[model samples]
Target: MTDETWSQLLAGLTNVTWQSLVMIAVGCLLIFLAVSREYEPLLLLPIGAGAILANLPLSPLVGEHGLLSVLYDIGVGNELFPLLIFIGIGALTDFGPLLENPKMVLLGAAGQFGIFLTLILALLLGFSREEAASIGIIGAIDGPTSIYVSGILAPHLLGPITVAAYSYMALVPIIMPPVMRLLTTKQERAIRMPYSQRQISQRTRILFPIVVTIGVGILVPFATPLIGCLMLGNLMRESRVVERLTHAASNELANIVTLFLGLAIGSTMGGEAFLRPATLAILALGLLAFVLDTAAGVLFGKLMNVVSGGKFNPLIGAAGISAFPMAARVVQKEAAREDYSNFVLMHAMGANAAGQVASVVAGGVLLALMAG
Candidate 1:
């Protein structure tokens, strides 16, 4: 090869700009958060790596025929990865906690209060109706739901929305604690919720996914795809005969989809896409969205506590934010901080699980409101 050929081969290195370096540093910080802080490592690590790879000048990981580009076209662009991931989430999820105490579903619906609240805020900040609606969904705290909603309503903002959604989700353990403590007193936090030893029949468990899929589909057709995939995975797990499928969906399929989803999202974090005033607004609104969700859940929990004559611990309400086991675990930890034997984890799980379902419904409602 001539000297000109050597220069052409090294163009990526030669053309590296200061902006790219800044983006690379940001990616490194994400990696550090994954490795040292152990914050959503599975997502942050891959996403961080993808950001670094994509930010390189003339990145081979983007554009037509690029590996990340192909992955995006295959899944993220078509909005398949999030749905696939939901299947895995359903396969791994335990709905028994939710089924035992159906009342927890109320907290789940209450938790979605922030999404609409934030939608107005985003609109006030100059985002269009569709953009504001997409931005508001960051409160869902479920990564797939955020991706699914944003990809539909405002695809241009998907990058920042996805980042804000996932990052705030990882921060749930932190964001929830102060709010939970502030909202409930020591006496309230010490309130104990008796675990329902009620057993859910195998038949009921098997019927749940089918019933949910049908009911939710009929009610909000926009939600059918999201709810359908999720229930399908759950059905596979509940069937008992499909143990192999369940295991694969929960493990192999989930892991692979997570990686691809992470890379696709990170690829969107190109220097031009991410380092903008709009990106900053998204991150800010996302934090507010999560905070508001937790607060709404806790306030409503407090109201229920009053109605139940102190039978309810307001901390359980914080678990209603669709953060899954993490939010539930946080509620349990807060309770344990007050009383070691204050075992409300199961109850919290019920609410937390309800939030999981309610969040998707809320997303569907948003879609119907905006697109329909």
Candidate 2:
């Protein structure tokens, strides 16, 4: 072969490294999980694509002024993307269930016990106080909350924490049901809480976000930005006149921000940065927090059951950790196994929605406790 051709072949072969190859494999695995296993396709697809691009030899995606770096600087670094995503979440969420059953708020608060508990555990394990606090928010089981808190308190760990939070959130259906069933009796699961689909007027719905933002802001000032943006989107959604804006926030805006956010987050997973014992520990601690949150929710449900003369199903308590509709659906399905006619979707949804708000509040509280 000519020296020019031989040199070109040798150069190509020299560019491949074990680290880059492993990262490419990991990226492919993420794609498989997202596409075939149907696990958080929206975020995982972008993350996988970013990882692949970043790992490619001589790729500019993670270089200065590169696409991933620019996106990260503009959004993740400034904590804009997560807040934007929160707006979309607010626009999409129906708070009617939570408003209809205000008492479920207690279950939501109870579900956050795991955050403080995990904070202590992480501290004992030798993580810095800020890092521990950031890790503890994993128990909130709310992706935007986790991202927001960690972004401010511990940006370096954002990739693993974000990935862990979303992955566990997706697994809520699988993780919660068995725990719910084990904690509640068959009779309890069979107890029916029929849906009362009250027609919430547009005025009431629009006012709900404003009222909540004011109330929560007064109580937790640090949560103002996250809560305010979220509530603003909700208000737009319910105002009955901002249909175009609401649609954009909930769909196009959300989709664009999600892509940028995921790519930027995944780019942070360089081998030297991610291949650490601390990352592994963070992963384990995240799972621990999730389990503890589930346990606390179930226990609180049992307490409610006792106080209400068996009217409340303890299984619904397991839905109170902000995994949202997945946790709620798991509770409903588990209840159906005991008695096919029993439908607890509304009750579970109440707890689920309350859990969502509570998780965000808990994230802010943890920040206060740690930063104070």
Tens digits of per-residue lDDT, candidate 2, 1-372, equal: 999888777874778777778777877888888999889889988888888888887677888989999999999999999999999998899889988888998889988988989999999999998899999999999888898999999999998888888877777777777677777777877877757777777788888999989998999898888889889888988886989999999999999999999898888777667768898889899988888888899899999989998888888888889987788888888988888888888988999999988998887777777668
TM-score, predicted candidate 1 vs. hidden true structure = 0.97
lDDT of 1 by residue, 248-342 (tens): 99999999999999998888888877888998999999999999999999999999999999999999999999988999999999999999989
Best by lDDT: 1
- The true-versus-predicted C-alpha distance at residue 112 of model 1, in Å, is 0.6
For candidate 2, give the lDDT.
Answer: 0.86
How accurate locally is residue 138 in candidate 2, as Cα lDDT from 0 to 100?
Answer: 94
Q: How many backbone clashes does candidate 1 have?
A: 0
Full-model lDDT for every candidate: 0.92, 0.86
Clashing pairs in 2: none
In candidate 1, residue 123 scores what lDDT? 94
RMSD of each: 1.4, 2.1
